[model samples]
Target: MARVDLNDYVYVNARVRGMRSHLLTRDFFMRLVEADGFEALHALLEQTIYRREANEAFLLNPVRPDYDQALTLNLIAAFRKILDAVGGEPRRLVATLLSRYDVQNIKSVLRGKHGDATASEITNILVPVGSLRLEQLEVLAGQREIRDVINTMHAQQIKYARPLIDAYPDFTKKDHDLAVLELALDKYFYRDAIGQLKGKGTNTEMVRQMLVGEVDMRNISTLVRIRGVRLDDGEVENLRIPGGALSADEFLHLDRLGDIVRIVSDYPDPRYRKVLQKALAEYQEVDLVAFDRELEHEMTRRGAAMSNLDVLSIGVIIGFMWQKNNEVINLRILLRGKAMDRPQAQIRSDLFFVEREEGQAA
Candidate 1:
C-alpha cells in the first residue's frame, strides 16, 4: 500500500463533492421514466453530465441504434476525468478501483470471442476507462479465439491476465463454460483489490469496507440466483469470494438455507435487513429485478453515509464513484425500458437512488 497524504486529498475531495451535486436525484429519474421515447430521454440527458457524449453519439449514429454505446463512452469519459482530478497515492488508489473496468472489458472480449462476435459488436460493450487504451482493447477484440485473447493479454503482461490464463485450460475443457472464466476474473479482482489496500494510510478502512460490502452482496446474490440450479455445494463454494464480511462456513450455511430472505433478514448485519425485507416483499410480489434495485440502493445508501462521515478521506471519492455509476445504470434502464415500451412504473421501480435523510440536499 502507498502512503496517502490526507492534506493532498483536500482538493480532490472538494472537486468530488462539487461533482456529486450534479448527480441525478430520484425525482429526475422519475421524469426520465415518464419520458415518452428515446428522443425525449436523449434530450433530457443533454441537460446532465452526459451532454457531450450524447451529442457525439447522436452525430455518429443519427438513428440512435444503440444507447449502450453512448452510455459506455460517457461512463469511460467520466472515469477518466476522475483519474485526472487527483495525483499521488490517491490517484493510484482511484486507478486501482477503476481497473475493475479493465477486468470487465477483458471479460467482455473473452465472451465476445467465444461467441465469435464481430469486432464492431464486441467494441460496443467495452468500457475503455482503465490503464488499457481503446486501441489495445480493439486489438484484443479482434482475436479469433478465446485462447488468443488470453495469450495476448499475458504476452502484454497485463495485470488481469494471470487469473484468466490460469482458468483458461479448465474453461476450455469444460465445454468453454464462460461462467468459470467469469468467476475466475471476479475472484482475482476482489483478491487483488483487497490485497492492494493492506497498508494504505487513512483511507484503507473505508475502501476495505466498501469492497467487503460489495463482495458480501455479490455472494448473496449469486447464492440466490443459483439456488434452484443443478450446481453442487462445491461449485457454489467456488463462486463465493474470500475477504468478505462472512466466513466461508457461514456463507455455506446461508446457501443451504431454504429461504434467502429470512437468512438475510436474520443476519448479524442490521444495516441491510430492512432493505432486504423490502426487496423480498417486492420479489414475492413482482420479480428479482425489483429486489436487485432495493439491495443496490441499500449498499449505495450505506456508502453515502460512510462518505459523509469521512468527507476528507477517500470515502467521499468512493461514494461519488458509486453514485456516478448508479446514475449511468439508471439512465440505461430508462433508455432500454422506454425503447421496449415497458411500463413507466416498472422502470421507475427498477432504478436505484442514493437515499437522503430529510432536509439533506443531493
Candidate 2:
C-alpha cells in the first residue's frame, strides 16, 4: 500500500524531474530564434547541454551547419538515456510510448525508398528512439527496393514487420502507395501500445489518456487530409485509430464535414475545439503548418498539465518527454528560420512553447 501510494515510477520520476530541469526556457528560445545565422546559432548551442553533441555534429558535417542533424541526434540521445535508466513497469510504459518513434522511423524509410532518396538522407532524418536502433534503420534505409526493406525486417524478426507485409498487397494494387504502409504501421503501433497499457494504475490511466488524445488528433488530421483528396471510403475507414476520446460516429461526422466551422463546433472536447477553432480560422488548403502547429501546442499543454499532476507516476515522464520533443521542435524551427533568414516574428510564430507560471517549468 505504501509503495502503491508512492507510485510505480517514483524513483524514475526523480531522475526525469532532473532531466526536465535542463529543458530550455522561453527566453533562451527567443535568443536562439533571433540569432544572426548558423555561426551564431552554433555559438549559442555550445553553451547548453547539447554543447558536446552539437560540436561533434558540426565537426562531422564541417561542410554544412547541420543544425537539424545535431538537434535530432541530441534528442535521440536524451530519450535513450532515460530508457536506459529504468526497468519493469516504468520501462514498459516508456518504451510503449516511445514506440511512436518506431512508427516514424519505418515511415521515413518507406517514404525514402519509395521516393529514391539516398540512405544518408534518410538516415539523417531518423531519430531512432524506439525499438529500432539507428543502425537498424540505417540498414533498412539502404535497401534499394521497398520490398527488400520489409523482407529484411521480417528476416531480423522486427515486431512491426508483419503489418507492413500485410499492407504491401494493397500497396502494389494502388500504384505503390506509401500511405497504405504508413497507416498500417500506425494501426499496428496503437493497437500494440494500447494493449500493453491495459491496467488500472494511475500511471497507466494517465498514459492511456495521452494515447487517447494522440489517437483523436491523428484521426482528425486524417479526416482533414483526405477531405479534398481522391481517397475512397475504404481508405478512410482504415485511417480511424481505435481508442480516442472521439467516437467512430463522431469520426463519421467529421468525414462528411462541409462547413469548416462545423469541425470546430462538432469536436467533443472544448479544449481541442478551441484549438480546432484556431486551426480553422487560419485553415488553408493542403498546407498543414497552421493545423499541425496548433494541435501540437494543445498536446504539449496537455502533457504539461499531466506532468504537474502526478509527481511520482508516469505522467511526469510522459510530459517531460513531450517537452523534450518540443525543445527539439523549437530548436529546429529557430535553426531553420535563422538559416533561411526568416524574420524573428515569423520564427517566433512557428514555435509551440510551454506556458509557465511563478517560475515553474511547464
Candidate 3:
C-alpha cells in the first residue's frame, strides 16, 4: 500500500468535521434514556444522522428483529460514506483502521458457530464495515462448525485467519472456549494496526498513539474483568497483548484490580494517568461500569483534542471514526435498554457521553 500524504487528507478532514457536527448531543441521549420504548427512541433517532436507519427500522417493526440489523446497516452506511469521500493511500489507511470491525465480525461468526447459532441469527449481528463483505460473512455464518469457518477463512486467504488457525488447538483443548480465540484475534488486530502505522509520518504518529492507548485500555479492562474469574496468573498472562504502555509482566503480578489504577498512575502517558485517577474516583462512589465509561469518554476527548491540533491528517479522520463508533455504541445501549425494559437510571449510568468542555459547548 502507498503511504498517505498529509496534504492528501485535507478535503476528507473538512468533510469529516462537517459530519462530526451532526453527532447526537448529550441532551439527546438524556431524552433517549427517558424514552418509553423502542418506538419513542426510534422517533428521537430519526432527528439525527441515524434518521434513515430509524425510519427503516420503524418500517420493519412488525418483524422487529430487523431493528438491530437496521442500526448495523446505518453504521456500515456511515463508514461507507467516509470511505467513499477519500481516495488512494488515505482510504487504504482508513480501511486498515476499520478492519477492526472485520475482526469483530469474524469473532462473532466463530462464537455463533461454536454455539450452534442459526445463520440468520449470526447474520443479524455481523458488522460489514470492514474488509469482508456482508455476503461473505453470511456465508461464514452458515458454516456448520468452527473448524469449517476457520478452514473457509484460510482457503479464502483472509489475513485474520492465520492467528485463529494457529490458536485452533488451544481453543479445542479449552472446550471450544471463544475467549481464547477472541484474545488471539484482538492481539493480532492491534499488532497489525500498529505495524501499518509504524514509520509512516508525523500524521501517522498521532493515529498510532490512539491505537496504543486503545491497547492499554483493553489490557487494563481485561485485567479488571478477569479478576472475578477462575483464571490463574499464567492464563491471565496469555491474554495480555504486547506494545501497550505497560509490559505484560507489569500486569502479570497484580494482586488485585485496584493495583491497575496505581499502575495507570505511573504510566508514561499523563493523559491516561489523569483519566485513570478520575475513573478510580468515580468507581469508588458508583461501580466498575462508571470507570469503564470514564475511560472511554476520556479517550474520545483526547482523540478530539488531537484532531483539533492536526486537522489535515489521519488524526482527524481517526477522531471522527471514534466518535462515530461511540455514537453507534451509545445508541445500541439505549435501544437495547429500551427493548429490555431496563430502568432509566441504570441505562443512564451505562451511557458514555461526549460532553464538550463548558466554554466549548454552544
Candidate 4:
C-alpha cells in the first residue's frame, strides 16, 4: 500500500483544489465594486458563501464593524474548513503554518491593551484560527496590564508566553517599549517554525522556503523601520532571521546606507530589488507602511504561485492560505469602497486582482 500520508494527500488535495475553484473571482469583485452601498454590498455577500457569517454579523450589530467581524469569522471558518478536511502530516504542515495566526492574535492583544482599547475592540481584530482558543485570547485581552497578560499566558501555559516573559524585562528596560517584545515573538515564531521543519523532504523543504521567504522580507522591513525608530543600532542584528536569500551582513550593510530608495535600488538581488521598485518609485521619503504592504503583496503573490506545483504537495495548502487571505482582504476593501461611495474605477485601482492562469476560470 502507498504511505498513509500519501493516502491523506489524495483526499486533502482534492478538497483543496475543489475549494480553490470556488474562490471569489474577478467577476465577483466587479459586481462588488458596483454595489450601491454597504447594505447592498452586504446583501450581495449574503447570497454567497459568507451568508452564515454575514447573517451572524448582521444580528450582532448590523453595521460595518460587525460585518468586519463577520469577515474575520468567515476567514477563520475558511481555514478551519481546510483543517477539518485533512489528516496526518498534511495536517501537521497546515497546523504549523496556522501558528502565524496565534502570533498575530498575541500582537493584536498586546497592542490593543497598550492602547487601552476595549476588549471587544481587541477581539474583533483577531482571526482566532490558530492553536490559541478564542477564549484564551479573550482572557488575554481582558488582562489589565501587559505584564498581567504575559503572566496570564504563563498561567494558562501558552507556548509563546515564555519568550515574551523572558523579554519582558527588556520591554520594561526600554521604558515599556512594545516593539522589543513584539520582535521577540516574531523571532520565536519564525525560529520555532524553521526548527520544526528542519528535516529533508520535498514538501518540508517547500514549507521551509515559504517561511524563510517571510523571514527575509520581515528582516528587510525591520531594517527599514529601525531607521525611523529611536532604538539602538543593535536592534537590526537582534531582529535578523537566518536562512533567506538576504544575509545578516547584507542586512547590516544595507541599513547603514541611509537612503531608503538608494538602499534598495543599489541592492544586488534582482528578486527583492523588483519587489520594492514600484513602491520606491512613488515615495519621495521613507514610507515603511508602503514598503511593508509591498512586501506582503509580494509574499502572497509568491505563495499563491505554489498552487501550480504537484497536486499532492503541500503547495496547495500554502497557496490556498495566501489566496484566501488576499480574497478576504480584497472583499473587505471592496465593501469599504462601496460603503464610502467611491467610484468603481478608484476602488478597482486599489484592489489586489488575482488573475487566473489562461484556462483556469474561478
Q: Clashes in model 4: which pairs?
A: none
TM-score of 4: 0.91
Displacement of residue 16 (Cα, Å) in model 2 is 1.7
Give the C-alpha miss distance for residue 303 in model 4, angstroms. 1.2
TM-scores vs. true structure, each candidate:
0.89, 0.91, 0.86, 0.91
- Candidate 3 on 163-233: residue-level lDDT in tens? 99999999889887888889899999999988887565777777677888888888877766666577777
231, model 4: CA deviation in Å?
Answer: 6.9
lDDT of each: 0.79, 0.81, 0.78, 0.81
Write the residue-wise lDDT of candidate 4 on 13-46 in tens digits. Answer: 7777887876887888888788776677777787
lDDT of 1 by residue, 191-303 (tens): 99898886857787777787788887887677677665676778778889887877777777777775767576656567767776787887888887766766777678767
**Which ranges of candidate 1 are over 4 A from the true structure?**
1-7, 36-41, 228-233, 265-271, 357-362
Query: Which ten-residue region of model 4 has the weakest summed lDDT?
Result: 353-362
Candidate 4 residue runs with Cα over 4 Å from true position? 1-7, 63-65, 228-233, 284-286
lDDT measured at residue 59 in model 2 versus the true structure, 0 to 100: 87
Worst 10-residue lDDT window, candidate 3: 353-362
Candidate 2 lDDT, 181-282, residue by residue in tens: 987888888888888887798888888888888888888777776675565666556679877777777776777774556666877777677778777766
Residue pairs of candidate 2 with colliding backbone atoms: none
TM for candidate 2 is 0.91
List the RMSD of every prediction in angstroms. Answer: 3.6, 3.2, 3.9, 2.8
- For every model in order, what is the number of clashing pairs? 0, 0, 0, 0
RMSD of 1: 3.6
